[model samples]
Target: MIGGIVGIDQDIVKADVTPQVDTANTDISTNYIATSNDYGKIGGENGSDWTIDSNGVLRIQSGTWNDESVAKFWSSLKSDDGSNINAGNKITSVIFEGNIITGNSLASLFDSLENLKSVTVALGAKFDTSKTEDFQNMFSNDSSLESIDMHMFNWENVTSSLSMFYQTGLKSVDMTNINAPKLSDASSMFYNCKSLKSAKFDGTNFSKDGVKLPQFLASCSDLADVSLQNSFTGKITDTSLMFDGDINLEDLDVSSMNLSSDTKTSFMFQTSNNVQDIRRKSITLPADPNITNSKIDEYNTDRYKGWSSNLSGDIVPSLETYYSNNANVGKTTWTLVEKDKSQYKVNYIDQDGNLIETKNESGIIGNPINTTKILGYSDPKNSESQPDLMSIADNNDQEFNIVLKKLAPYKVKIDVEYGDGHPSESFSVDIPYGLTSSSAQVDQSILDKLASNDSLDLDKSKAFIQRIASGNPATEGDGFSLSTVISGFNIDGSDFKSIFNGTIDFVNEQVDSAILEGASGQTFDAFEIYFDKYEQSESHNNGGSTVSKEITDINQKSATFGDKETKLYNSNGVLIPNIQLAKNSDWKNDKQMILDGTKYYRVSTDAWVKASDVYVYTDNISKIRVHADNRSRIIRPNGDLSDRALEKSTEWKTDRYTTINGEKYYRVSTEGFVKASEVSEYK
Candidate 1:
């Protein structure tokens, strides 16, 4: 009776159950919220340190506002039962007045402050979550907490995290400075986080040592532009209905995933189907031939009986720029060609179009290129669970097509894998039907010209193939018929010792996404573009057969944690705790970072002021509240505490700074003084 479609012609009905109000309700107020001790902090040793004024502003009068429970500050007139008053819940805001929270898991300490709407951690305070794990129910069902700035909290070793933020009203979360190497169970961790708008989880957040992640962010329906590959790099054995209800996830990349142990993935993507494109052809089995995972077949049968997996291994490389930049998407290629008599080398180009050296081709060559070395080989099928990278043909069409498969959003990716173990025969191009080309260049140039013309007429495409097949004339007098020229390949694969394969990626509007057709009337995402760079199949011997050593390569960003240093390098790039190393003598020269713009640098690695000793003045005013109740005192210009004590109402004005015995002090006025650690810095 509570949920259904609210049609345009329907008038919505509501239940009018009114709640009772108190006769003497002070809730209707123009005053602010102050120290209520609403959380039963009364009769304690430091009891009178905090108090609220008539204007409702809760202010800390003295002492560190340190506490184990933040909710103790909340209370309303209705819950003040003879000093049993509740704290934090009734108060909409609180002033820290300067308190250093040395407690753990401040995420959970605010568990009782469900009504707390805003909190500001003043300077000189630090919150640590270095060893916290169970943030479950930490902010569970806290509907009133709209924002919690966690930029300053440290989360170094958080582990078990079940329902950490179940049903909270957070609009955004700051997951900065987090390190959860031992994280295991995170089921429903952000379950149904309906209001979570954006997230900033980096690669380290999902490293190894964590357990399987299932239903972790299951129903985070409002999330978009998320990279599942970026947020979770741990094992995922059971992904059953993991994202069954996420209705707004736009793109997902699960490429090169290790599903060797994944036995059950039923309904994992049942309802998360409204996507633009899947990133990669997810591996069912790995590339290894020795191992086979049988569970994948059962999962496929049980999970995809009705719904389609939109995941695939077939690719369509774009040839639209075949005449221009030779921009191919899959694994990139490096070839070697000859400019007339000069053997000009062909450099490899990355996916980003940057020219990279041939494998082991740069720097000093320790040894000569070994022709006896068998670099690598390729096959139609590598593993039972993995996709067939060479499944490009549709019902055995002999002639290579100009047209591509019409899978929108998903373009073809040719995986230009590095390292050898591939047969060059697995990657050869078919000579056009009528062309008897002794020259690989003439044969390839003709093909590239036709492929670049997207709207090439079908009959003309057929004629070109037939002309090359039966030996139609481009003219025999042409000079392309040499014994061997450039072999069509721009860069030779043997130099880099690379392999070739294909993958699936989104239709990149940034590079090329043009679709073309072949002589068989079938269309594809790409035509045989890069293959034309190779010589006619009779040049170089690949696998005992005369095939050019044409190849491709794509740079894969290695997933392993590459950085081992965890020390925080501050503005000056100086490593703290190594302060003694900064002792400069007449022998050591000091380096200076250019004082341009707003750059920060460390003058001496050994120099640093204590946090308690540092304070900044605002608008020419550096005043502090008098919290010394009965022990108020004055100090002389000579930096000595006066024998005569001052009244409690006197305010101290800070003027300048000085270091006495390595301890910093600020002059509140001409002769006034207060230890920096004893009073809060006024903003």
Candidate 2:
């Protein structure tokens, strides 16, 4: 079937006589075989007879059918008027009935039948195939025929079944009972049976000596399952191209078959690498050591054949050595690939061994690593520089730490303005990078640096630094300056660096003068650092108690001082230096306390004075009159005086009041407080 041979002998003579049959009914089954006169075959035995019934069933009844007689059976069919008809195309079914014996060559018995659909041995039939030797093209190329039931067939003497069912439309085959002990060649037995889905030959033995099975099931494209059990027990000589193109065959086990010493297994699995499991039980190499060693060398070097043998046991020591040297004897070679870059992480660990940050990147081997600088991190030794990249090890678990050090605060020059008309001086103070909030106090080291400078004559005891509030300091008071005197010299350089160009204000006070009084009705600004000269030493009396009580009733009321510039005193009745209240100036008072046999009231955050210097009111005043020309000043929340002053003889509206050193102060703005001694109610 593979080479398109029709398998008919060319020497057969043609027949001239036609059998008598009805012309109207042209179906081949409705006609019968020719009589003695009508038959014209020139060779073979005459015992076999062919007949067709109305159902298109062709029966070979009780006779011996040889190759030539069977070929003549094709020419014996006729119509009613003795016209030749194609029995191969018209016959729908074939049955071997009664006692029958086939000759040595039963090849091409029903080959190339166009419409033939079925073939079967009838019940109670004694069909014999013990004498048949060549079944080369039997039943080959019958495209429309789907199946056959030949369970009674005994293939005990079949020598060569080459192309027996080639190119047929068979869906499956069961040759388990068809044992061919003498069968040697089965090349192309089921080749190109494209529609065949499965086959079973598990019982059929192919153990005969020197068995040749080339192209046994090659090119069965649709074949999926093939079962074999005791079929391959004998010594196999030639198995080249045995399963050449059975692409859909997934598993094949020829492990039971012991290959002869001179077996030709070249390309046995050619173009069939998809068969995942192939078991070779025990393979015996050639008896000659040179040939066996040469074949072993070829197996090791053969690149054209992609199959790998699963040879479990080797009869020769050379093959055993080869199998032992290569554990994956049939597997492909190893391939190299690049490593993944995402898995290598560079951890930035601090000096305390804490993981501060991490970076994921892979560097090329033997090349300098590319790195970036973190904002506030650096090498421990250098605040301005980062760690060298080459120093970090290149490994997945490598801890790449440069001993991450926090960057030192950089120095920024700020202009210090002394509100006492001194020339503003510039000093450098540290401002850390990426600072979040305002610092509570300037670093003491910065103050020490300023104190050591020879250009500025600042009293280290009185000198303090802080940020200013507005662009015009005289109107808006100080910036967060209450945190300085109430706490320490605080710095909020965030907005000040851009808005005020790093400018700070410093005011000098006359702390040595005693009773520094203002003119009559002269309103004064609340003092910043009210007791700049007093250190609150242990020598000062506490009047039997250290803690002061809250005077909630008259806490925010106004107090009118005496006509003379009222003198202020401390909690111990000691006269305070450089501070006094103007005569008749209305002041707001807060807390009142008795100390050292004298009653004093606190008018600011730190300042307190004798209660006799002012007359405290029961109710808070809404307006205050400025009596001093330019002495009236606005004080910060921390009791520091700002540069602003109230106009003389001007009446200012007051929202609320608080007491500082027994002198009441009224709130004229957000944080500016004017002392009651500097202002009185305008009438």
Candidate 3:
């Protein structure tokens, strides 16, 4: 050793060593340490250990090594046996080229580098599939790792259970030959790795042949878009659920797939092709072409044209074209085409080969015609000019113009002709000037008042008058009283009484002189006159009772009875006092006698006796006579009998006999007799 004293110049170092023990030039190994020379080489049997700074980049010396030198050196050196470097050491970058690094056994050689930033296995290098576990573990702990290029090796027989690839900050992954098949459970394989923007899959190699598609893109919330390159032939039982969880994906295209309408809920499309065929065929249009005409008439009119045209072509042109031509001339033609009664199809065709429109035979002949003829005009030849009749001679023609008067309108008689000569009889309807009473009134004030007030109250007023006067009682001298006439007739009964009594007095004075002595002239019998007077008094009393009871019942039932005492009929069927009850309370007794027509009375009977008189028994025997005329007699203490007569009694006689002062007294009467008299002093 020529004095291993190293001379150091500023930043340059030079070292020289002489081989003491040299066996062969290839087997000779040298170790040298140089400081800052920028150029050095060591020939060795074993690979040299190169130590770089903490942040230094180690690369193969390119310019100094020729192809022959690299070949000779690398061939002789043991190929990168990393036994010198410990496992789990830090590494910055790893790159390999040529045959230096061969199999994944090299991965084990670098497995100790936990802080590896990048790993690029060169082409033609073999990756040991069994060491996938080792490399996976290495990558899992290595957070500084940025990229991995395993494209060189076909990673067959590699069972990679590493989900760490997704967790890593891997910008790109080259899994070109991954051979594992059961990847159905690998959900979110690339979840949240926003750095990964582009990816591609070869359909042949990376196809989801039996694998479900949802497993591939599940939980990919950021995956807002998707595209399919080819037709999807797989059976997607529920395509709706495929995108059910992808809320961000607003649109999808299943146009490439053969989707069935049966499974689709809402298939909105431009045509009916997307809908089931049966539904599209069910739509139909109505048979009648003209909307203005009734459907029945359109059918019948077509039939009439067909029938008339079939008689002769000259009489009626082709039935189909007749209406079209006539419609231009403002005329409509009815067609009646012949048909086989059983078959509804119109068999006849026009010269133009159009089917002749036909009406249904059942509908045409079976329809019952309903027509009404209104009275058009009325002719009055001549009428006398009276206060009530129109004058015909007043006009120059001496004929009354009996045209239907607008003032008193009358409707025409209408008759309906049903089939088979059956004609409905004509009837007349009174033509009302207006719809209702309110409309008929010309005055706006009256119409307004009528509308504002209830019509029922006015109807009640008319009914009130009719209810009080309706019966034989009003004519039978038993009429309404002062109170009832005031309430029911809605007038002052005292004023009515004054007017009526004055008329009666005037009539009586006129008849009084004529009736005084006449058997020849209009004579009045005193008894008949007296009976009429009595009946008038009785009727007045009874009519008042009926009206009072009706008003009372109405007032009691209604809480809203006004102060003006509204007159009402007895609708509740309350009995009027002094009116006789029906013989049977059941109201079905026809044999019951009619009192005042609407009432019945119970019948009564009485017994009659004759009195006997004696003259020898001196108990002041008095003789009295009773007449068959209705009268009564009573004996007085002065020995005189007072006589009272019944107005219209039919029969009467003595009721008893008495004896006084040794003389028998006879009780006799034109009416019934009462004989309890004192004896006279002369007797």
Candidate 4:
């Protein structure tokens, strides 16, 4: 009467029954009990030992069981109280701890155990059957066993699995870790396991050749999932009635099965009508001449039924064309048969082969590719003809390329600047391709200023821009401008016209300051205008010494050297040798000349200076009176004072003036000049 909790528990003694020992057991150092009311012996004499607790838990501790029918031994067991006991009903669980349980077979090991529910191989121990070759009926007829932890089982040497879990109450079985490379039989392995909902064998190794699998999962009416992914690597000899009554299976993937020419596949999927999807690597029908197309049709119509078929590998005779030759033969209607479409991507690239955008597409073999136009871009080669079809016959990802060039013009920024830190006027214009200014609407004021300076060569500056726009090499300083200058641009180093399309700041360094005009904020400058006029001097006979009185020109300009010392130039606008002017020096000039777009003032008969380097004032002085000291000594051309002097309090007519040591000297006589300190204006 084994009515209690069904697991391992300590046997609390209400009473004790003496253990009986056989006379054949000679080892007195250990208590080798043959039978008892509290426990029973599992291992034979000279083998290992076991015990059954009051909770009906059989604990086999550190031992081996001789290869024999363990179920039959349990049916005929007797207790040490000299009474017959039903071990099957009393044993509810078996716990193996610390040892080897080897045998030639595991057939009927736990068969028909009406109350057996669990078998646990403890951690740090294994149920080793390394020498066994059979697993027939291993857990057969165990209608109460819902699960088994066989993770620690060593089944490397097994060769058969016939009816292994037949008619069991297994809800799920994960034999993913099983490795039986020599196994050849799994017939009826889980046959009639009506409660099995899932059986996973993802990593199991069943590599034996010509393996038999007839009725493997037949009659499993509740079977919903059976995963055998990549578990088969052999030629199957038989698959008849493999899933005969598995009406709940929705999808079956036998893609790994290798059906040889001599294989038997009769009723392989009999009554599995719920399955809608079937996948296989390819179809390899038997090579026997007697097995005709009619035979295969019968199998599909009466046994293996599938709603859709997904097959891989190339078909020598297409599935539809093969049946076309045999119009009399009836074939199953495969509602959907297809191969996965190959995926590819089209990359839109710039002229320099830089990727801009990508489009992903998919199609079957020989399908033409279509493309769309991108704004502001066009293919230079006009090679935008329809691209080649999807030539790759397999379902692999690939890529293609289409190069495009920009069609829109570059927006260049035009800036008018003054070198004297004045606010710059900026605007943007659409410069055409090739970096040309043909489409540019330059400010008329800027162009007018550029032409106003006779020293500025407008043709040369326009030519410089033309060189860059025509794809010729050009540098920033190569071009000149009176009102606007281009800076920070390099044509050779830029890729894809990037530098040309960016900001092009036109800076006018010539105009240091400007005045706003007409309230439009657009200013213009007329920097130092030059004229072609000449001056004359008259000689007056003073004491018969040919005293040439310098005649004043009403248009004469009074020029003063800038704060910074500057060099004097010849009349031809060339720098005078060793003629540097002191700062704040003053000179009177009536003539001007234009050179390199800059105006120059003629300080002497043969010397000139840039107008930009000095400040000019209107000269209206015509006569001067000598100081009362009367000692107005005359200065020689070599800068020495002469013995001659002007009469005291006498007025004289003068016109020319010169700078000496930054002092003003006026011409009182043609022979020498008088210091400005000794002269006063004659009103």
Task: Tell me the tens digit of each residue's lDDT in model 2 across 201-233.
Answer: 666675467578777777776665677656666
lDDT of 3 by residue, 441-558 (tens): 1222211211222111211121112111221112233333334434543432222222222322332233332121111111111100000011110122354553211010000000
Residues 497-591 of candidate 1 have per-residue lDDT tens digits of 11111101111111121221112122222221222132321134445754322111212111101122122233333446643221111111122
* TM-scores for candidates 1 onward, in order: 0.32, 0.37, 0.21, 0.38
Model 4 root-mean-square deviation: 41.9
- Candidate 1 deviant stretches above 4 angstroms: 1-99, 102-108, 112-119, 144-150, 173-177, 228-230, 235-241, 255-267, 272-683
Q: Which 10 consecutive residues of model 3 have the lowest summed lDDT?
A: 549-558
The lDDT per prediction is 0.34, 0.50, 0.26, 0.52
Estimate the lDDT of model 4. 0.52
Off by over 4 Å in 3: 1-53, 56-90, 97-116, 122-138, 141-147, 172-194, 204-683
What candidate 2 gets wrong by more than 4 Å, as runs, is: 1-43, 53-55, 66-84, 272-683
Q: Write the per-residue lDDT of candidate 4 for residues 1-683, one digit (tens) a residue.
A: 11111222221211112112222332222322233323445545434466556667665656666766554455466676877677666778766655656667767777777778877665555567787778888778878888765454556777888888889888777777466777889899889988887787766666466678889888888776777766665667787788777766645555445544466767775654443322121223221211222122212221222224323233222333444443433222233223334567778888777888796655444445545444345532354433553253454467778776655533333343333344544444443222212212222223323223233222222223432332222334344332232234432211111222222222111111111001111121211212122122334454555543232222346444333667788744567887777765667776655544456767778787776676543333455767553457777433667788777668676655555433567665443667777677532
Model 3 lDDT on a 0 to 1 scale: 0.26
What order do candidates take by TM-score, descending? 4, 2, 1, 3
Off by over 4 Å in 4: 1-40, 79-84, 272-683
Backbone Cα, N, C clashes tallied per candidate = 67, 30, 40, 2
